[model samples]
Target: MRDLPDPGPWDEPEQAPPWRPEHGEKPRYRYWPQGHRPALQALVDGRWRTLQVHSRIDYPDGRVAYQGEIELPVEGRPAEHHHRAYWWPQPGRLRVAYGTDIAPT
Candidate 1:
């Protein structure tokens, strides 16, 4: 019979587990209205991180009218991707803009 390898520290379950806020935490920058969308923020290793930005529009019947997502890069210079629903009404099509001196990847 073959001997099984032992699991490392990560393989063990949490004793106390992590704490998650009930009403969610605050963000560094201004966020959109709650009815408009969902936003997230976090601090890792003392550095601020913007996790996600999501939003939706609802119809009178309580159906999803529109949806959008904004994703950020994981490392190095920050990058963002903006995606939105095709049916939402807006002026001038959505445009992608990067910070000053940053080139699109």
Candidate 2:
């Protein structure tokens, strides 16, 4: 019978094999929530301004949440300022109010 091919270095028992064990693990954050609506209102010197408000929300762990930049215009300034805030559903309602100003920027 024909001689079979040698197993080579891989067949050596003294050498350790290059293999990694599998460990199925889950991620730390969960899926984001739905039906999240955010509204913004601007004011200057205790008076409400005409500028509109914009916001975004991200839920990481179901209970814990994160929010992004909120942009709004001041009374006199031509540019918009961006602010960030976070909220907890279990706690009471949180509102951010501002006063009016005469100067812009």
Candidate 3:
């Protein structure tokens, strides 16, 4: 069969840069409900093509930041948590690693 001449809506969008895991783990921020939380950052989002992997974000100081944080307040408490997650892109899907000795929930 011959290849199609002009592609239509099938055109793909700009792909996101691949994430580099630090010591075999990506640096991401996670959150918890508190009281029973992880030692480090809590879980938010770590899948491929996710908004959490934004390239550049505008900072309050008129500076572009490559990273940002997401958090939520705990119920009936005046505390909250932020977390970072690690991810790996695979064929047609993505892989996530919480951290050393830590598994994805």
Candidate 4:
């Protein structure tokens, strides 16, 4: 019988979302789970804006959260906005749609 070698940091994801200078160390990159392509939206400037999900987090409190970027028309060269949202059933300033349950803009 052969002994298996220890896997260092095997829990880490193979790929991670791009790191932005604005994003501090605490909110590290997390992998978005497969087959869980839920469109996320956040209330921005009094309107719901769709987010380009970069990372997904499953909190210890049984709440799922998403962090991503959104492009909005701002008076600047870069109009990309960063935001986070929790999955539906968790009261938040965001909305989530799964499968064919998409909502109109």
- Candidate 3 or 1, higher lDDT: 1
lDDT of 2 by residue, 1-105 (tens): 322233232211111111123322321332223333333333333333232223232233343332333334445767464433333331223233432222111
lDDT of 3 by residue, 1-105 (tens): 322222222222222233444324443433333232323222223322322322233323333223223244445776343322222222333222132333222
Q: Give the better candidate number (2 or 4) by TM-score.
A: 4
Give the TM-score of each candidate: 0.21, 0.24, 0.19, 0.44
Choose 1 or 4, whichever is better by lDDT.
4
lDDT of 4: 0.47
TM-score of 3: 0.19
Note each model's CA RMSD in angstroms: 17.6, 24.5, 17.0, 14.3
Candidate 2 local distance difference test against the native: 0.30
Model 2 bad stretches (over 4 Å)? 1-63, 90-105
Per-residue lDDT of 1-105 in model 4, one digit per residue for the tens? 222222122221112233345444434336545444456665555666677665666544444556555555455466655443334343355666443333212
Determine which window of 10 residues in candidate 1 has minimal summed lDDT: 10-19
lDDT of each: 0.31, 0.30, 0.30, 0.47
Question: How do the candidates rank by lDDT, highest first?
Answer: 4, 1, 2, 3
Best by lDDT: 4
